[model samples]
Target: MSKTRNPNLDVIRCLAVLLVIVIHFFLNTKFYDVTINSWQLEIMVGMRTICMICVPLFMCLTGYLMHEKELSWEFYHKLWPTLSVYLQSSALIYLARIGIFRERLSLADGVLGIFSYSTAPYAWYVEMYIGLYLLIPFLNMIWQGCQTRGQHQLLVATFVILCILPTFLNIFGKMIPDYWVTLYPLAYYFSGAYIHTYETEVTQIPLRLVTLMIVLLSVMHNLNASAGRIFQWLPMNDFGSSEIYALTIVIFVGILKARLPKTIGDIAKYIAPYTFAMYLVSYIGDQLIYPIFMNWFKTESAMLAWMAVPILLIFIGSLLLAIAQKLFWQLLRVCLDKFWQKYQVL
Candidate 1:
């Protein structure tokens, strides 16, 4: 099948990357002295809950685009570059941390550390993404076999029960199978396929309703965090604590319906390809750059700096890196093609 690029999807990816950066800022920032009712605390909780939509939206897009594609050498070929970035970024982060902190790095530590993003926790998405890629073919089979919308909906409903419902119940102290967590991405994969196949119109009303759900869920999360003792009857917070799935679908559909100027779509197409690169760069920023800012700025001053400076710096840096990566990949492709031609001539 030929590849077609959707400007709207690109816009979604670009937005997801930005959301990811802000979420990382919230996660790494220190709000220790801030009270539960403090503005900083509220902002942090809101950002995290809202930004949880990022990964799921990414997965949905992936499924929508690639679920039907055959898993061949081309599949791994496309994936290898992303894996390379993860490995190289992890190594660089490990080396930088050990060097700066004057920690000893043994051979086992060095080699193993390069593959594991121990110091750079945000790269956990890479591992999850690889798992999702492996399951795509199987997921495609399921998608293909479903002859009717009802059949697919039944499967999705079952997934919601087995994978999603348990997490909600767990918040209430009900224990479910631990294995259900592995199936969460599958639910999202199916969701993306459903959206694409059915071409459902997620109009303004549904978007507003989903937005309200996200707000309510975020507030519930903050209340639980601040007053867990009082809300002891609430389920244990797990994968289901937020409206991530709902918000992701809403955001994805909203983007699809949005009518933008040709100039904006053109810009989105240009920027969309670099979002993964931006994500990698931002992961490095979270590990290396943010800490320096955290220490430099003190107290509420730090929160303000976090809200302003770090985000801009990370964004600017990621944009440059993404552009550079595009150039680098282009050069590499040219070199490889030339080499293949020379060998064929020989």
Candidate 2:
């Protein structure tokens, strides 16, 4: 709402965004988690834990900026822009896929998978984002209708409870036909929507400090137990221990908002903006760029390529997608103007 960005929020977004990239980054190199080699293990564990916050934080940002007391036609009016981006991204993805897969892929797979992101190349997040955009007005109803903090917390708790149940019964993982995104991501979406709609800044006082301690404990929990898969109790997945993840995120944001514009804060914001583009082009990096180069390291030639290649690939790929998105947004704006002219109100 202000002309200036909140360096604090931006920093959080940036770090959360890059954690998503770090997932693939670790996958591409010598990040296997054998005990004697634990530096990469730390990276792998940290990344896995951090990524739990990414989408939730994004939706919280969405709810923070866009929520309103009443569902408006204006929400419906934004549809063309969101749809246009989604469609353009899908098209770009298809082209990228064709380039990558070339002759080995079939026309039918292309036709179906173009819109289906789990099947498509790294496009699942974008698809879920578009899906969330379509649901905003309904979520707006929930956010706006909750008249008290208690009510808001109740609703969010209900959402988390439903999302977590299947895991206990093996329902979320197996009995539930579509486990990963559909039921599970709702906890993130619901908690984010509720918090943004209800709370201001981060929690204050002893609660805030206690939350930070809890976050550290949770991170260490994962770090110490990732090899055993016991720490998989953390809700990075649909059936993740969402209570811990949500609490951890809440705590981190408090510290984040307070100390920004420093090195960590700036990078946290700067790196996140390109996460969408990075996802779009990550396979390109992983398969084509990083693997061929970064994986060649044997410690004799230096581990330099491991870091350099992933960063370079992410930067170049994100730059091109950013340009495309800018142009696409401009086109969407023109479309909006035309629609406004026809409707007399926008």
Candidate 3:
């Protein structure tokens, strides 16, 4: 049997996901809803600024749980379920878009759609994550030899290189870096896995100092982006980033560490399995649900409704996706077992 993994990590992951959902729901609703309200617009921008840290935090978590044991074709077997989830959701979404959006489709589009990285728009992170997972054996092999202290040092050094290198290349804009040149987001996973395997504890440091550093870095990062400058001083600009951004992720991890666990076996089991599913479903909601909600509420910007509406939708959407994924997995497992049972008897 596999060893029991970190319990707190799950809760932290759940929170990070929620933050992403919360930020997206609010940001999209504010920006795209039928009519824009001033207050809601400002709040959306503000929340967008705060929520920007979600992905970075996610990267940090991925690093924290470094199960760098071995690499095999078998390691990829876990992705099959996730792969199934992606396929099913894509089919459902494509059908819905065709039916509701009145968007035209062709056989070529369907072919391209299948190779989609994640859900539809968020596919980049999804496909890339599986890619990184596949490489874990090699990365772990390199990491395992280093002492704990060495691993931590490597992470810091890697962070600096990943963060700055992109900026230098990007100095010339689209012509220089292009698509393939970007790898910072991928670096986050490496950073996270490195920490989990090597970095001993976040608790040893004082919380205030940690908080200050996170805030400072995140601010500088965002300011650079808003200024239309050449270099984005933060982590992972393509997926959305700011300089102080990674710092915020670290700070949030510290906060997560301080909080008590809010979930047990069942609740944990319920939310944990669906995290990716929810990630996929949220995109659907972003494209479809928010549009309808925007049309319905007709809320003015700068109003509390702007903030409240998206948060509610995100929570509901994520919760529903989590539940649906669990049931789907449960049914699939049962059916598979039955098939084997029949085969054995035959």
Candidate 4:
């Protein structure tokens, strides 16, 4: 039998998807171009910093949930659903570009766009995830080999040093060689495995403390952005820095520790499965909604004031598209199965 779903993990998945939408807000708005002169802009910067944890949260959740997966044909076959959704979403986005945006392209270019993720640029995560999914079984083998908690801790620490520290240290005169920093996904994966291994101990961490750490990290990220603006040598933002790593851990733990109501938990569980689809189709919603809002509001700051509505509209629109896509695929599979069974009988 399949393992029961953990509502807490579901909630984390939901939160991760929402944060993904929130981060895209910056891209859709003039937040990047506007000068950070007012408190409104500063708040937006702080929110952007917090939302940067979106991708890490998803990566860590993968490690936490899939830590025990073994190498097998059955395990590898699970990737088909994700790949199917990605292809369908890409096709939908391409169609939208052609029909809604009136963008013209040859049939070959459209096919190539889906494969290359040019149709839905946000499907880049899907591309990254395909490689990571292939490696998970081997990754779990390494995890299962660890004889003790200390070994697991050492493994996580080593990853941090290799994947996270370089991006952080390189900020100041390239103090650390960052050639291995792209391996940060492995760092998050192992970290999630460690958390899963020690859930009892991790849950004991105070929720208040986790909140405090998140707040501090946001402040530091905001300051970092400000400093980068003041000094040309520094980066304007730290989207995938050690700060995001730390914040993702704290937020993940905090959500796990909190006592969510039954109704809220159930809602999260229902929404969680749809989140991957939502992320893929969100580009459609963004393209549809942002332009209208941008035209309505004169400044990025003005749009920020009424941001909640546009965000909600985009979320709802994307969720509807994802649900429709899911239904379409389900029906297709049913039809294919019926035809195969009839042919076999004949």
Candidate 5:
């Protein structure tokens, strides 16, 4: 049986989607074009570091929520909803590209773009998710097969060494072979599983300490960015560093342990289901919103001053679009069912 929805997990989902929008802000604005000499720019880099966990949060949430999954036809069938949403969202985005953006494309190319995820660029997450979804049952098998907490710890530790550690070590000078670091999702997945398996032990750490850890990490990220600017050899930021893994874990735990008000929890639960659709459809909002902001604000720094409004607009617009697509899909399903019933009677 499926587990009951956890409000805290839902809140994490909402936060993850919002951070998705936050990370994309760098791409939509002139964040990279300007020099990072100023403190404001350095702080922006820190925010980017924190937001980098957006994808990892989703992956870890998958492990936390679906740790009991096993290989079965019914289990595999769960993918249909995700696939359906993606295909429909892709079609809508394709139409927007042609109609709104006035991008020229032949019929075959349009269809190809939809299937290939080229039409909605952000749907690359969909491509990654499909592979991860297929592997979840097997991953759970490994999680379940562990006979003891120590064994579970060993398994998670091994994944960290192989997948997470290399990303951090290689940043300096390829200290370790990183052939398996691309498999970092498994490391995060197993970490989430470990947390869920030992919630009592994991949550025992004080929330204040958790917040402190995140703050210190954020500062480290800022310092790292500054050093990169000074040295020219170090990177300005590493996308999936060990720092992100540490932050993702502590944040997930802190939120899980907090006593959020019911109203806030309700809002989170409502928004959770739409996050996947929101993430996929946000590219539409970005395309529509960013140009207007660019026209209004002469400088990138000036635009940063009014960042919250555009982010809010994009979030709201994407949420509405996702809801509309979901309603349209449901209506079509109902119509097709009725037509089939009528044909069967005849």
Candidate 6:
């Protein structure tokens, strides 16, 4: 039997994807004539900055769920679908872009892109996930070897110091050695596992306090981005390293602790199954629809209302697409199951 779904994790996944959509909507698109000093600009920018947590949160969720799973045929069986989606989405996106540009599709580039180490736009998350998928067994082995919670916490802390901290220091013009590139996804991945395994009710940080810190840090990040953009000469501390990851952990913890109403839990279950497909749908919209929307709405004279319309449209449209895909997949799965049952030896 399939494992029971965790409602909290499902809620977190939906929230993360929605946050990502918000970021894509406003990150480059100009918002309604708002100057750097405007309150609206700060809110928009701050929210975008804060929502950067979504990516790391995705990594965290992966670690939480998969870190303990054995590296066996069963693991690959689960992992293959994600790999297939990445390949399919990248190809579909390339095709869509070429068609939009009215350019000839280069067959060689399309095939090569499947194997390319370089990340396609908005597809970097999948690339990182692929890397982590390969290493999860070894990672779990190491986690299993830890005799005490303190040891696991210590290892995660060491990664934060040696690998994660330098990312923050980069804002101050400090650079770490190049070899440290091997550490990342590792830092976030193991930290997620550590949080899941070692963090307990007794050790839990208060959600209220974490929420307050997220707001305060978001304001700071917003200010940093604004100053860099407005002054032109100042550095933007846009590294988004520590604060993003920190907020992600808090959010994960908060979700873990939440007891949602039955109504919300049902809704989460309904939507959660389509989230991966929604991500792919939203990404295509990000590439294709966003530019078109920007052309019509990105004027200095545009109202804040107008600025919001595209985000709403893209989000809703992606959901509709996800729903349709979910229905289609359900049908396809039924057919496949019937075929297998008829053909296979019991």
lDDT for each of the candidates? 0.69, 0.58, 0.60, 0.83, 0.82, 0.69
Query: Comparing 2 and 3 by TM-score, which wins?
Result: 3
Give the alpha carbon lDDT tens digit for every residue of 86-107 in model 3.
Answer: 7766765566567767668765
Q: What is the C-alpha RMSD of each candidate to the true structure, in Å?
A: 4.0, 6.4, 5.0, 2.4, 2.4, 4.3
Residue 281's C-alpha lDDT in candidate 6?
A: 63
Per-model TM against the reference: 0.81, 0.70, 0.75, 0.92, 0.93, 0.82
lDDT score for candidate 3 against the true structure = 0.60
Ten residues in a row with the worst lDDT in model 6?
231-240
Give model 5's clash tally: 0
Model 3 misplaced stretches (Cα beyond 4 Å): 1-5, 30-42, 100-102, 106-108, 164-181, 198-201, 216-245, 261-269, 296-304, 325-346
Candidate 4: misplaced stretches above 4 Å? 227-239, 335-346
Q: Which candidate do you rate higher for TM-score, 3 or 5?
A: 5
Residues 57-92, model 1: lDDT tens digits: 788788778767776778767888787766555555
Per-residue lDDT for 1-346 in model 2, tens only? 7577666666656555555566566556554433423455555555456555655666556655556635678766776755454455556556666777563556677667756763346777767777777777787777778898888788767765566544434434555322543455556666656555545533443466666565666567567656543224433332245434455356444644475547866665555555555456556555666656554665512543356556566656755675666577688889998998989864
Candidate 1 at 223: error in angstroms?
2.6
Off by over 4 Å in 1: 1-4, 32-35, 88-110, 117-121, 175-179, 201-205, 227-242, 301-306, 325-346
Higher-TM-score candidate of 2 and 6: 6
In terms of lDDT, the poorest run of 10 residues in model 4 is 228-237
Give the Å error, residue 202, model 6: 6.5
Candidate 4 TM-score over all chains jointly: 0.92
